[model samples]
Target chain A: MSWTRKHLLGLQDLSRDEIQLILDTAEPCKEIFTRPIKKLPTLRGRVMVNLFYEPSTRTRTSFELAGKWMSVDVINISTNLSSVAKGESLKDTAKTIEALGADFVVIRHYAAGSAKLLAETVQVSVINAGDGAHEHPTQALLDLFTIRDKKGSIEGLHVAIVGDILHSRVARSNIWGLTKMGAKVTVIGPPTLIPQEIEQMGAEVSYDLDEVIPHVDVINMLRIQKERQVAGLFPSLREYSVLYGLNRRRLDQARDDVLVIHPGPTNLGVEITSEVAEDPRASIDEQVTNGVAVRMAVLYLLSGGKDIP
Target chain B: MSLLIKGGRVIDPAGGIDAPADILIEGGQIIGVGTDLPAAKEELPAQGLVVVPGFIDLHVHLREPGYEYKETIASGTRAAARGGFTSVVCMPNTNPPVDNKAVVEFILAEGARNGAVRVYPIGAITKGRRGEELTEMADLAAAGVVAFSDDGNTIMNAVVMRRALEYGKMLDLPLSVHCEDVNLAGQGLMNEGRTSTLLGLPGQTRAAENVIIARDVELARLTGGRVHFAHVSTKEGVELVRRAKKLGLRVSAEATPHHLTLTDELVATYDPNTKVSPPLRTREDVEALRAGLLDGTIDCVATDHAPHSRDDKEVEYSHAAWGMVGLETAWPVIYTHLVLTGCLSLIQAIDLFTRKPAELFNLPGGRIAAGQPADLVLFDPKKNQRVTEELLVGKSKNSPFIGQELQGWPVYTIVGGQARWVDEIGR
Candidate 1:
């Protein structure tokens, strides 16, 4: 199918076919990374802007690399060092970016629906990097790519997303993407950390990680913010690690072929242990590598580039 | 000047009248109500219309004495007049809140000077609404406050709330409480449910409101103080209030038109206008609220007519201010959604807006009989109008109902026998 959508706001609104098209396009994009030069002229002369309202090291850098590899001019505007620090509104900042002639705007804002707001205000194609706890479309896309790459197919795979499900944009987007692609997904976290009525989104809920581990083909662990302990969502780091952390003992109970994945900057001893992270079955590093390819697929499609090289 | 309101279905629930009648007004009072006895010096043609006692909104934020950029007493009262409300009790959450006698007098004076309709100020329960020390309730009541509240800030301290309720009982004024456990509702932007999960916005659980409602009802029973729950939005909250009434406690509750009609599913649009305190709940909650209104478990329909500046609502949903401008849209929305949908009869709905609210707060001007104040609204129930920016007379236009076509808009709002607002287009 020809690309028609101008923005990638969330996985919830995308049709199954649209998601498949994105994943299918990522196949060729992934091949370019193994080449010596790792560059493409398909999107040459296109301008993209990374407008991040929150501090980020990974998603922003991944988008930057995606734009650079595609020969697109990329500009980074961290809010702390820009007009936003002087109290400029999001609308004004988006308009300023549009007036500067950027063709694509990748936004990571601290407020939910900020990316949608920017898309409504500008004529440029917008990609949601992450918007509060709302959605991180690209992160979910890369995750889907990594899963498909490792397991050969996403259909019929039982994936368990464990940890801080209520506050994790990564978890929400993955649930939408995974469910639409015909995966049986289960979200496991403390009852307080799991959002209410999430089963309506086509996911099963569980509190015990070990019980769910034996039945799943993939385990996507979300980072637990230390502030959550202070806010009283959970008791303590030691207690959380004991209850939900993916350590060697829990890994032993999982399927032998089970792939453990994490959206990086993991709390080492909190959600996942050093042994499990370094397990050959763990695809954490490979997920980061797939992130750039998925973003490239997004950038190319949004810019109306078809006939993937 | 003596005036005659000619031939209309006058629904006066307070007087047990619902029939075609002509009202004769003289000296700012209804002198006669029956078949026309004689023509007067002035006449208003009200044929093919339904005339009722003007609406009484128990909760509104005039945003005066401070945040005038959002709404001044002048603009808010004008909007109330256009919405068919003749009397509105303004909440005390404005800057330099109405916690003292001086602030109460200032609001009353400002309302008298610039208001198009009567505006009654509600004094704060705490000084600055800090939920710390209790305000001098007796002094504020003496200064002409119709009630007491610390709306927009729930009294999180049960001890302080109980003390305030004690003082309220002594003063014989109901404390209108905005109930929500702050810690339980932390950083939540919308109702916690399927919609919030799908949208990925932080969800404010219904338990947050229910827990406080449960606490405050016990406190009301303990102190024998009259408690008025503002904008009760959850099913369990409605049930709690129902139980409170069954126990014969001096407790009352109101549901806003938005909460009674809209649901949390609308938040999918990510419109900041839909953001409200106690957020729009599920369809089941809306049904419960409608049931409460029918069974008289909920005392009245309040507008909770909060107004905010455009800048306050034109941003991200999480960053946007809570509340929508309700005064100008309350009647049309309720009329179209509730009355036309058969959830309520015309007279029953009018009673909810008029006599019920007046009786709860013990305010004047909710009846239409000889010697009663001539406050009335005339509207064609069959008429249709789309809510738009131009249709909103309030200074702020943060209404979620904008662009919605609604029937039964008020055409002429007569306050104290004078026409405060007239719809030239409808006429």
Candidate 2:
């Protein structure tokens, strides 16, 4: 299978075959980490720039390591140190990077649709690291890869995404990716954190996670930022923890084979308890590892890697 | 100056006249409106056109004396003339803010010097539109300000608003309001609903505008002040205004041509041109606004012709400035969507743009009979037109209707018996 799109902006517009093709290509990439010579010469001459307007450590580090492991050169540009501090516009910064011959530009911005704006301005391939609450295509791709690797199949699975769905770009991307792969997604969160008309996007919403736990095959817990709760969405953190927190007692209510996942920097006792975070059934570590493999496949395919067997 | 408009279908809603007639104008006042009228120095055969009273936009941002790079009294009124408007009541949210009698006098002087059509200034309801203290409403009225409004910023303090309304009744001027609660509308770039969620932008819920409208309608009832709600964009807002009108309260509301035709679905593209305050709502809201207009719940259709520079609008959706340049497109949009589609009769649509707003603001030029000003627009509804950037006479070309094909085109816009702006169809 071949990947033809010039950019990976979001999972909402991608077809099911295009998604499966990305997963299939990432399968061989996971094997490289086990070898002593972990580097590959697949994209040795390519240059990728990570342009992060918002602060992020895990996603940026994952992309940098993915590029180095494939022997591709990667440069990181945080807005704090760049000319963006001098009031340079996004269009000018993108043109400057493209003029320097970067093959791909991965951008994360505070404004939704900013990645799409950057892609239209430059000639190079673009990847959306995360744009506001918009989408995180690579993260969703990694989640899909991890889910499929563990379950051996993705079709007809019931996945419940819990926590702050309104401000979580991860939740939106997963909703698009998982639903496209024939998974029924139930976004479980407080009404304030769940944007109105989210059901129009083909997701069933439930406020009570306990009621939804028994019917799900996978539970992806999104990290709840303290600032989101400060907007008077809920009473307090302790109250939130008591209401939506996934503890050992609640974990036993699920099926024996049910998998728990969290997009990292988990608030220990806020969204999930310590016991459930390190539970044997949790796939947090696998998601991080698969994140790198999936990004390597994205860079390879976007740089014109023809086919994978 | 004497002028004759021949064989046109004249629709004067104020006079309840809709028939083919020849209007003879003498010294800027209509002398006759009958067939076989005496010949004048200038005569035009307007057989295929429909003549209506000169349109008046109750809301517009001229942006002069400060942000002239975005618009000026000259370019803004020229745009109004091209759109078949004879007068526009300019909003008071300028750089220095039109809070004092001096600013009102300054705007009147500039309008006389450079305006292509009549420009009426609306003084600020609060000092510098800060929403804390009241402006000198009596002194501003004596300075010839047509209305009072703190547009582009809502009067957040309810006590200040009540005092303004109570005092506004004595002056007999309409208190226009830009209804929005900043706390509830926090950081929202678009309307709150399915589209905003799908697009991942912050959403401003309908309650933000609705709650403010509900409060002001009750205040209008209490103070007995003539309250004019500017650019009402939500379904619940229309309902509140409708109920207030039924209760015989001195409350009126206006819906913009943009609000009546477009919905929040357009914001899915994240085009900052669609970014407006009281952000464009759902299709249900648009339908309700149209219904309100037809049933007399919405009294007028204002342009809300806000102008912004290309630099201000070419940025990211969240960073881009709010508003669109609307005067040049308001007529054709209403003509196509509201009039031609049978949602409202032609005469009813024309009255919203003409007599209703003129009477609300107490401005001149609403009628077109003997002893009335020769303010008129000859519109050809069969003309096929497209809105290109070049077709706009305004200083800014940030209109949402830039690429739309519309049905009606104003052939001749005459003010004070002079053909100020004439389209190709008139030739």
For B1-427, candidate 2 gives per-residue lDDT tens digits of: 7888998999999999999999999998889998889999988899889999999999999998799999999999999989999999999989788999888889999998888888999999999889999999999999999999999789888999999999988899999999999999899989988899999999998898989999999999889988999999988999999999989999889999889989899987778889988688889999999999989999999989999998898778999989998888899999998888899999899999999988888899888778888889888879878999998999999898888999888878888887878987454
Identify the runs in model 2 with alpha carbons over 4 angstroms from their true place: none
Question: Each candidate: what lDDT?
Answer: 0.92, 0.91
Question: What TM-score, over all chains together, does every model reach?
Answer: 0.98, 0.97
Q: Count the clashes in each prediction.
A: 0, 0
For model 1, state the Cα shift of residue A244 in Å: 2.0
Model 2: lDDT of residue A72: 85
What does the lDDT read for residue B293 in candidate 2?
92
Off by over 4 Å in 1: none
